[model samples]
Target: MSGAGNDAAAPPLAGIRVLDLTRLLPGPVATMQLADMGADVLKIEDPGAGDYARAMGPVRAEVSQFFVAVNRGKRFLRLDLKDQAQREQLLALVDDADVLVESFRPGVMAKLGLGWDVLRRRKPTLVMCAISGYGQDGPFAQLAGHDINYIGYAGMLANNAGPDGTPALPNLQVGDLLGGAQSALQGILAALLAVKMGGPGRFVDISMSDAVLAHNIMPLVAVNNGAEAAPARDLLTGGVPCYNVYRTADARFMAVGALELKFWQLCCDVLQRPDLKARHWQLGQQVGGADALAVKAELDAIFAGRSLAQWTETFAASDCCVTPILTSAEALRHPLFQARRMVSQERHPTEGVYWAVAHPIKFET
Candidate 1:
């Protein structure tokens, strides 16, 4: 099944030729998905250092774990873009490619004589995806930034990052992977469809900042407009006790998420905490100004009385709506994640055994 042709044909992208010119997280993650889908992804790296990510430790065989995670299944082509010869060769390659993706600060490509305008003239049916921190024309367009910076500009990190305590990087590359790379991929795919509709390849201008805004639309709306979009004050954020983390007898923790009244009651019933039977979302709202210290104390005591293992076992049997909080290492071994292949192990040429967070795309086969 790992090799070509199992149940589904090789891939939906078998015939497509992609030239990946992006490095680091955003661009690489997008192309990795395309490569997994069976496109011919030729990754062009700088001949001098290869990719900056390749030397970023933890390094293996001159390839970093960061590099392998995203650059898999692609043929690596080392080209010195500064050299006129290499630029010529790259243009020749683009003439044959169906798609081209780049994340260099805008104008870098144009200065190098490999701009989309010139490339498109060479091949009419080529899709060009340009990814940047802001966009092509905004005041911040040329201003360089990374995942956290773009997230900050988009106001997602500002909302999620703490003023209550320490300001933390919110899962750093998650935003870039989702907002930039994935968005760029969707653009490329849509352009591919447009090609079939009798248009030439399209230029997809993807802005990481703009994409993050899209990602945080719901939360942004609440903040900008009214109660609907604001977070942390919401039930799922931190407002309700039913939808929060709970600790167990041991140092380990369990997440309690009984969003509905029936679910909340079920948790209370299962835990034998009848004193808090009436504490639901609607009830919590009335007691908003009042400290629910008594309720918190009771649940804390109940959770502290049981070991994490016991709580997990109990949750497995009854639908009390709670589960243990496993660390990343423990999570891989979790039966639920293993069954779904949520975590996969790969023998990285340098990093030995490394794990890949499986892309959420499922197939018919």
Candidate 2:
């Protein structure tokens, strides 16, 4: 309750203390979001080798850039949970912590004698979040898995494909980020709110696979309606000509999201193909049907006639929901991100100037 007084300028999570036992991506990024909002996040690592991410990917000044990017704005500590003395020390720290987030397998924390039952007996108001590939007490709870496995289990991987209908591995870790991190964030915040209202603390069990499965909404809708949810044959998944990716003469890609008829008409106008506007999904043109594929092929040929840069310029002023597919490096330099300050450089003590992605949340004060 340090900064819980009525102060308009104080950060939202100013008084919150978070004990982070998570390493690598999902758990670390979740706590980092809290830290960005002025929570005091203490990332506790084992005294042995510490977080494996410290050695993952490219290194700069003896630290992994991957680790540096996700673990910014947090304090660090090391303790060996196996040792009684160190375990006692962690328990003492837990006494002062408002929240604890961990990403271990289901039974590891219970085996450590630091399970939710023990912690809740000691402190009833402590919110604990457990993040894992599968939910606690599930058939796959004890099984080891990663982002790819989780998304595949959630039925998302099957739908993420191209015209060839082969499942494509996405560069974005949707299962890890959306499923684990964001879901845990939501649970933690809701539990914190409940505690603020004088309720007992809650245990948040986050399963990456379960989360992604819950969010794979469109395909589920189709299945519930007794329709087939085929790969690359769904409305949002390259099934419709108006919402597909097209390759340009330079082999670069453009994302078209002209789903609505208005946007489709605008896109047709920009492409100088007014005749194509009548063949929209709303108008009896079946999605993933022969007509739709023919229209997509026609659009593809038209797009391949020009360079990506030329198409980008052609659609710059049109509100047709068409945009060039930018690489990660190009996205960092894009004017949209620049204007919003999404990416900024922070001087790490050892790593020098490293790029940091700003928290997307904004508060007016």
lDDT of each: 0.79, 0.92
Candidate 2, 1-365: lDDT as tens digits: 12235455777899999999998899999999999888999999998779999999888887799999899889999999999999999999989999999999999998999999999987899999999998998688899999999999988988887667688999889999999999999999999999999999999999999999999999899889898556787899878999999999999999999999999999999999999999999998998899998999999999999998999999999998999999988898899998887887789888889777898886665
TM-score of each: 0.90, 0.96
Query: How many angstroms is residue 40 displaced in model 1 relative to the true structure, after the best TM-score fit?
Result: 1.0
By summed lDDT, the worst window of 10 consecutive residues in model 2 runs over 1-10
Best by lDDT: 2
TM-score of 2: 0.96
Report the lDDT of model 2 for residue 110.
Answer: 89
Model 1 agreement with the true structure over 1-365: per-residue lDDT tens digits: 13234575466778889999998888888898888887999999997876688877666666777788778888988899999999999999987899999999889999999888898899999999998888877798889788888887777765663225334676556468777888999999999999979998889999988888888865666667655423343445555667767777778888988777787888887887766768766665432213433465568888989899998888787676777888878988888888877788877655688887775665654
Compute the lDDT of residue 285 as modeled in candidate 2: 92
